[model samples]
Target chain A: MQSENLISPGFADPVFQSQAAFRALLTALSEPGLIQQVAPGFAAPEGLEPATAIALLTLADYETPIWLPAALRDGPAGAWLRFHCGAALVEEPAQASFAVIDGAAEAPLLADFNPGTDQFPDRSTTVLVQCAGLAGGDIVTLSGPGIAGSRDIAPIGLRPGFWAEFSANAELYPLGVDLILSQGEAVLGLPRSTQIVEVR
Target chain B: MTIHQSIPGEDTKPAYNYAYLDEQTKRMIRRALLKAVAVPGYQVPFGSREMPLARGWGTGGIQITAAIIGPDDKLKVIDQGADDTTNAVSIRRFFERTADATTTEMTEDATIIQTRHRIPEAPLTSGQIMVYQVPQPEPLRKLEPRELETRKMHAWAEYGLMQVKLYENIARFGEVTTTYDYPVSVNGRYVMAPSPIPKFDNPKMHMSPSLQLFGAGREKRIYAVPPHTSVRSLDFEDHPFRIQSWAEPCGLCGAKDSYLDEVVTDDQGGRMFVCSDSHYCETRREQGHRGTMLADASASGLVEAKS
Candidate 1:
């Protein structure tokens, strides 16, 4: 894992930068469909968005197992993650605490990852997907605990039938994966508790 | 580039990291917090760190505050609804020094509130985060002593034992005798312990605009109730859950709705009930809201002057 291939430093001021990023992530998750900007000043490798990289750097640790698709695994992304975050790379998607899905990669079935048990629903995976853009795509309205009434978001670059799969995943209630969709420097969250409806 | 260092006048070097806990620990706790919010009321296990404060004395809430607090936040700390108490003062000062954030006693001005044993009488608005200090995060701890058994029960949504316990209380006392630390079901799914707050404040947990987070350091657990979440106190149809009420208003602020603290005035069994929330009382008094005690004192003073 020590093989050097131009790995970037974690953060200029690790504490302040990570704290800011964490707060943004919290806001994004707390208010589902809310997009928050994350400018951590870390240079992300190719094929990985800066927001996704910032989220991983702020949330993942050695104890957290990260799953990367073949595209992300073969590139410099895996090494970069291992170098900076010290997160373990898991082979199986279901075993991962966090998983990264690139825009070009096929979206894995939500059931492939852990939805956690009834007792410990928080043990479910947090999926970070790289999107082409956060705005001007298929519009979906979200309503849930954090939302006041409803929030509309349209994330681009997702494969067809993503919402259908998400609808099924949301049915899990207390047991489902939480998603963070990143495009460039913006990230939007869609927690399991959120009720999503296509604006067709 | 050294960002933090001890000055010449300082006795001991300020060696502690910003907000006390290191960045790694904060990240770990932050991840747990996100999950806790995602699944409201579910207790998510985290690596709780040791703070300067003792275990039971709000170490859990301190850790959560430390993880989330930044330079921009306005913090408020309260113990039993009073901002001037020992625990509240110490916690407030701690954040002021470490996080360098502004501290306020007023509930309306605070962005983040860390409280033990009580919720503020004033309603919390949207965007504010309430952190509750919890000694015991498990709602079924008393009923089922075994941790493994209780975890299984929670997994299966087995709350029959809790219902039975409440039923027995009703059968014995003709009403539910339990008052503080009332158990509530979060989002109609996970039954949660809403800290040691009096039953009177339990209604504030339902559909509240502010996000509520609970931390139990000794138990190494963190849980949350997101904004607009449903929190229902456990009760039966025959005897619905009721809050504590008093015939007498606050002796200091003339507030009939706020929770009162019974103060012993003399050894001759004289007592006066005052508002537990000192800030609320002070604010009301400033607005010319006088209680019975104040009225009596002013009247006696006028009588002495005339004589």
Candidate 2:
């Protein structure tokens, strides 16, 4: 890890900033497909987006194992994460409590990560993926506990079969990866319990 | 990002960290909270911290409020549906001093409500969050004393023992005798204890717009039911789950729908039922919904003035 990469400060007032960011994260997860803005002024390395960086800083700690994809692993993003959050960096995706996917196109299958067990389903992974935009891609309809009736989202940059993979992930019920899709300052959550269907 | 050295009125009590719990502890709990929301009804273990209050005195709910609340949130605390009770008032004041957040007794005015043993009669909206103080997070604790075995049972979705216990209740009494702390299935997946709220309030948890979070301090567990989640109280098909009802309306508020607490006025078995939610009762009274007790008091006062 390079020393210059660690120059970026964490939260200036760690207590308040992290608290606000965490609350935003909680609201995003609780209301699936709801896009939220977090830590507006916090800057990250070249590869990492602001929403992704804020999510990591708010949720990850020493107990959490963060897995970085090849691009982030070799870049300044890894060092910035290590310097700010102090979370363990895992080489394998299956062992990660949190995983960062730089781009939605390069994202791995949902099954590649831990789905946790029936009793301890919360042991699964939470993946943060950078997307091109929160809106203007293939329209996805989400219906689940968080949604009152149904919600329509158009997330860009995902590959062709992303919804199929996500549907398969949803079939796991209580055990599956929770996703946070980020683009610049905006982020949207897609918990495993949500049923996603791509509109024709 | 300027940090304050001391807030005004710091001399009243010992200086505490923002929201009482430190940043590291808050982060740990926040991670667990996300997982808890992801897997609705599943208990996620975390490092439960010691608070100024004792374990059974709502330490779990306090830690949760401290973790999620900021300076902008308006908080409400309730004990047995009353905001003026000692436990509720103390917890409300604690947050006011530590988090520097606004406090309210009105249900509709609050963004976050930390409750012990009851949900408010008023319906919760989409943006509100409810934190429940749970003495025991596990619904299967009475059936299985060992934590390891209970965890395995939850993992396997083996709720046969719980069903059997309910069956035994049916055998002893004609219907399910258990009233408070009724067990419910969240999203049809995991069996959860809806805190200690009366079964009358159990249905309110079903498909609620507001997010619901449960915390058990001694048990070191946190669980959640996100907005619009399904929560069904466990019961048989033949005998459906039912809420408690009183033959008489509230003596102070004239409300027939609210949960009532019977108050003894005289030793000769004379008693009056009043609304347990003091705020609700007061609001109704202000709206000119007078109960029998209020009517009687006014009548007596009029006679005294005439005399």
Candidate 3:
């Protein structure tokens, strides 16, 4: 299907791909820190991964503004998203309702994104980051509400320098940004509520 | 005005993003959904915005659906499950036009089912998720209107008030007057409103394989029943949980094990019983449950003539 023409009339009727995306998101959100696959046959943005694009499509709306990393900010990818999804591009990360980082390596530390205010922790930003791998490796011990005691998740790629930043971010408690790390088709969640520690 | 004046093109610029929500709104909803799922029947308070649709008309279901829908998935929207009824048609048509996902009438075929007033009679599988449109999310809202008070009540595990209300209902009507949206406690912690589905559908919510999500747009809350979660209707042991019973079969499907919709057919109030789950009814009919009209027609060999 032609890229421009494909989305215009909306996905050919009856399957309801958007609704499926919505349900996947709820399941992902419900079981926080769990990996859920995005619907098949969805077109991923040039630099953005499928998981990131799926999250964007399901949650992004007219009222929210999106911030794209410098790499994909000015191109056909940007125009295509604007034309189809109607998300606005914001210069600052704090102003962005949703921020898409092509790769977590370049993604700003947890503190750079909005952690929200004392009264309303839910006002925080949700960062969708792209990763090279999603599973299988040294496990990070995570403890939180959804987790039984300490659940092991595949270690996420991050700069060693960012540890101090995240440690400080964790201190903020109720006010912090949530994250979704995507690798091609696979998507894993890391809501702010989760306490993460690297286990040797 | 010429056709060009009305049509929106690349030059005109379409309003709204790919999924109709901006990122910030998506994050807000995502956070609420997480809390809803985490608490497991606790009504999470959210700042619900007005959708393009009306307040009471499936906005809660629509918001929850919007928060969860991804780009590559199938969606089914049903109001009583006909898929052609005015509201169902409008909602299915809404997602079809905006989100551009595939829509279907079949329950087994859909991955996400956004429903109102009823749940499908067919048992849902683990693969499927049900989003219910809730007018109110709090089971205690009618009993107590204040949010601060309810939070305190939940914190203290205080449900005596809800039990007392049910007890009063027993005293007044000799049975619970609540025919639909009957309150139920989840995992001994939170009391939740099971959308507005009639009491017959309440049992279906208990320990079902499918995940159940409830959203109230006007009230701005979200809640859920995870796969195989214990959900109990608030009642005395002697009172017991009961499903609405009818002596007659569905007028259209001739099925007995489904929720029946009461219909008034005559000035004398003669009634016709029919399946409230329109899709289930249609499926049974397709499988050959011929009701009064079809049965009479078939018995006379009029089916061939009609065809």
Identify the leading candidate in terms of DockQ. Answer: 2
The alpha-carbon deviation from the true structure for residue B273 of candidate 1, after best TM-score superposition, in angstroms, is 1.2
Please name the candidate that would achieve the greatest TM-score relative to the true structure: 2
lDDT of 3 at A184: 69
- Residue-level lDDT of model 1, residues B140-229, one tens digit each, is 999999988988888878999999999999999999998999999988888999999999999998989898999999999999998888
Considering summed lDDT, which 10 consecutive residues are worst modelled in model 3 chain B? B1-10
Write the number of the candidate with greater DockQ, choosing between 1 and 2. 2
In model 2 chain B, the worst 10-residue window by lDDT is: B1-10
- Which candidate, 1 or 2, has the higher TM-score? 2
Error of 1 at B124 (Å): 1.0
Model 3 residue runs over 4 Å out of place are A1-25, A29-34, A37-200, B1-16, B293-307
* Candidate 3 chain A least-lDDT 10 residues: A6-15
Give the range of the ten consecutive residues with the poorest summed lDDT in model 1 chain A: A102-111
- Compared with the true structure, all predictions reach lDDT values of 0.88, 0.88, 0.70
The DockQ figures for the candidates are 0.63, 0.72, 0.15
Off by over 4 Å in 2: A1-6, B1-14, B295-307
Q: Model 2 compared with the native: what TM-score?
A: 0.95
Interface RMSD of 2: 1.8
Model 1 residue B206 distance off true place after TM-score fit, in angstroms: 0.8
Second chain only: TM-score per model?
A: 0.94, 0.94, 0.90
